[model samples]
Target: MAHALIRRTLHAAAAAVVAATGLVAAGATTATPARAAVTCGVLFDDFSYASASDPALAQRGWHIRTSAGGPGVPGATWSAGNVSFPTVDGQTVARLQATTNGTGAGTTHAEMSLPDRRFFEGTYFARIKFADTPVSGNDGDLVNQTFYTISPLRYAMDPIYSELDFSEYLPNGGWGATGPTNFQTTWYTYQPDPWVQDRQYSSQSRSIAGWRDVMATVSGGEVRYYIDGQLVGTHGGKFYPRQNMSIDFNQWFIDLTGHSGGTSVWHENVDYVFHAKKQVLTPAQATARVNAFRAAGTRHTDNVTADNSCTPAETPPPAGGTTRIASNWNNKCIDVPNWNFADRQRVHVWDCTDGTNQKWQFVDGTVRTENNKCLDVADAATHDGAAVQIYTCNGTAAQQFVLSAAGDLVNPQAGKCVDIAEWNPDNGAVLHLWTCVGGANQKWRRA
Candidate 1:
């Protein structure tokens, strides 16, 4: 996000001041309003590459940072050499090794950042290992093991300028603080000048002792933070990022005037990093999805792209909900005729099977089929016995029906309930509307 500015030599005193006051605590604020948002499927990476030279990582928008000059006068030297891909637990993970020889702020910091910045308001995930205590002899150093997101630092006033820090670990304390305090922060910037800083942010505190799964979902006007499948905090306000951001990870010292510097190759491992635009899945669902991809031997994919046209988030995908509407009168399930895909097909009553074909979603003002079509009052007729048919969805009242308290799917326009022809219960019976009859045949069940 702000790699160019963050890795370059800047005002150390100002940067230290920003890190001190800016990262002191966590809180919430009022969220700002915006237009509707869009969504796509996913972009995933398992970090299966063996080195930075691997084209896979580059093809997937990955760039290892090895520039200088940042929070410290010369932020830990970004070194591609310190980046590695080592086998861990039978899988290859991106290994970032940070080393310093107690010199000035001249430590070697391993970091990588993605190039995509259109990832606003969606689910994100990362499996990481914050080795606070070095594997070898390094320990007690105030190192920061981080995973974050940032927008182009064009200018603080740039509407797209935003940042979200999922994990910023200070193992040996930072700026008058103690060891082992992890942070999750959301940011909005305000610049009084170029060198000096005045940015606003909300944050949450956490303690990470080992490998942990981190995730966040930015939707419904809020940003939700989670660690290891547990809710951590929610941030919403005028600060909600105005645009997409690049994902990043780095491990470096806090640069407390060299007091926090130390030697010994310390490392942070990343098993994977994933993103699903506008799709909010449970931690279990996310893990399962990732596991499935791994089991299928998938290393990376960019198939999921930005959907510029905003589409309102609807109910879960057709196959995800636990809803099957059954016809009580027929004691059977209401399914599409012959499992056909043709529009205007009369819905039929079939022997109860509790299958996906019988599934229905009553969203907004319409009862929709699993196929993204709508149950319609044929030809927009408002007669008592108007024909009922399946049709391509068009957000129209003609396709809307309410689940009445009387247990009837009543088309309010015609004031009639969906019923089987002649009160028949045989399989393949066509459906139509009739005067509300509070009887078994007139009733439906969401079983």
Candidate 2:
């Protein structure tokens, strides 16, 4: 961990090769280091299962190292026994161990992957550990701790392939490079025979020999890498993944340059991983999302999404800023009665009064009142005439309301527009979600 920056040359073809082989890449283009609060949207897993073959794992699309494949060198083989789940820090973590039983013939790699293959774009998070030396013995071996996405080839030399190595940590140096270097490689394909598929990647040399929070955000055609909550590098352009990928984590040796065939075990610990598809949260926002999940006592959840694509908002909020939201038809101001913060509190149209309750902030694809509460569709209802009430904002599409060009507040997730009950303009007339009609009750004017 002595070098400041690994010189990652932008040889399109060599980027993928460098990453796969654990070569310390020197960047041709300067990668701006990000220093900010870490945050993201996530798919979370705390590895609380009893074993790799636990029923909960199959239900959640996880499988251990049963498949024989080498992402490393030819001698760096894979085996199932090298993978285990043990308590680390205060929680059970997915532990991938690569051990060489005194000979290269018995070396084994440990990997776990999501077999669902539905993940495409979004932020990715994993709290992990990178060991520079063996837990009990040895210090000169080369090991890789990786978190990546891959669209496995359906056939030999399949053209429909993609991969994004969000992180490839070479803790003790591999190939011809120095130790403690990290990389983020965006690959479209690595086929070099009939066709040449290239990649875009960024890398740096630093000391990360302990538990580190690694993050990646894939949104708006850009791949941003983060350490802890600060940005490290960004990758984009045509090499952005062309298809969905299965999330993967593995620990293996990069033994082509030097081999340490010692009878010792090398471990990589992952506390949890979080993925939020179709959502690109800022570092602070991403942290909050994961914190909320932990707060809710979630050790495992597949209820959010493992879908193919993320549907980002098409239109941004109007640039005018916070204003008085008055129904164009009745001229009454949309209000969060008495500045209510309670869930399901009825939001109504009252006299403008210019009070905080009557004022609204249109920001980041959602509408917020005086505080963190947003106008939420009750129960995230999709059926017609669902009530629109005040609720604490949790960054769900249910709370995301888009003001349309035709003048209606629409919740795209529900495919419903915000409307007033029965066209009423009374002081307590509540708001609801109905089919968008571009009608008077659905139209609002910012004052």
Candidate 3:
């Protein structure tokens, strides 16, 4: 996710405290430990590819972004040409090069992403070499070298959108700041046009000029960020990721303000990346795993699968009993707007009343209204923000829902929850299918 830089002086102090505590050396080499038993799925890649276009790369779910977009200098093309796999410091590494000639059209950014959005609640570790100065240009330019995970933002200030930026290293800072700052930001949601953001970030305003271990452990509802084995920040609450996200790495210019004269080129190098699904590993343990993989001559491994074994089964409500399903956010009932009985009419939250339109019964695996229309995922769509509407009762998975013990009303087909759009607390706010982030807007109860 793109972010406007905001200074947090407290984080600088926190970095100093961490440095004094001797948690771990910044660039120390980790010793290869004995092979450990793998209790869960894991992915480790050492970037041993011939080039960005290598067939093996695509087969392994890697994509070299060739799209044109924002999150960088406006009009700057994200070019596959800028991504390369080369030998650096005696090891094959994925290298991203971004160049600019002090003009939007003359700039090119590099990004590589995994197509799957199945990563959630895991330990993410990477060894990256950050450059404070351009590899072949005049000294100053505002560049962001990043490694992050993000789910699509369906709408402005989407309540269930998830992003965890493990690291965004700005060698020459942008967004109204000075040079050489690094940030670890956890996102809740944001608006792009007016630029309003709801997030928590920790930054260190010193040079992160060389290879460093950047790690994040997501567990027990908190995201803990570590650099070189020292704890840098811990963010939780609303910022906790509510869904799976793609793993990505990119190098781009925040803007051209710091760009000077002739074309300048910058580079970010990634030696390896590791992820342990549903497991929280310490920085030391993560590094040890990386080392062990290398020692065993395993250049890449991915045993991670989309495991939904924990999904709760549908439990029907009491026989012949009907109740009002109210949102935990505002105590408003799930209502068919205007008492509309037409099929495919979207549902919304409204003040609870004795109206039959607001009354619901859990029968079979579906939540049905007093009028017999079932709450369904529109057109059986599985994407985020799919409409939650009333449709003629049918035994499709789209109409099946499980009210999990945690209060989430989940559509088993989409694996999403019925969410009050945009976190709006007012009556008549529309509801839609969104990632189950356990947010108040996704929680419901029988009232």
The candidate scoring highest on TM-score is 2
lDDT of each: 0.65, 0.67, 0.77
Q: List candidate 3 stretches off by more than 4 Å.
A: 1-40, 308-447
Query: Taking the tens digit of each residue's C-alpha lDDT, what string does model 2 give over 242-272?
Result: 6666778888776634444457688999988
Query: For candidate 1, what is the TM-score?
Result: 0.61
lDDT of 3 by residue, 1-447 (tens): 244653221111121111111011012133532111112346788999998879999888887877666677778888899999989999999999999999999999988877566577878999999999888978798889999887777677889878888999988876655868898999898777676788988988889989999999998899999999999999999899987777889888878888879999999999999887776777877776676567536688664444423332333344446989998878999999889979999999999999989889875446888767789888999777899999987546677676766788877566567889999998889999876666789889888
- Predicted structure with the largest lDDT when compared to the true one: 3
Name the lDDT of candidate 2.
0.67
Per-residue lDDT of 382 in model 1: 65
In the predicted model 3, the residue pairs found to clash are none
Tell me how many residue pairs clash in candidate 2: 19
Q: Cα deviation of 229 in candidate 3 (Å)? A: 0.2
Tens-digit per-residue lDDT, 137-189, candidate 1: 55676677888777655544555567787777766656445546666777665
Lowest-scoring 10 consecutive residues by lDDT in candidate 3?
19-28
Looking at model 3, residue 31 earns an lDDT score of: 52
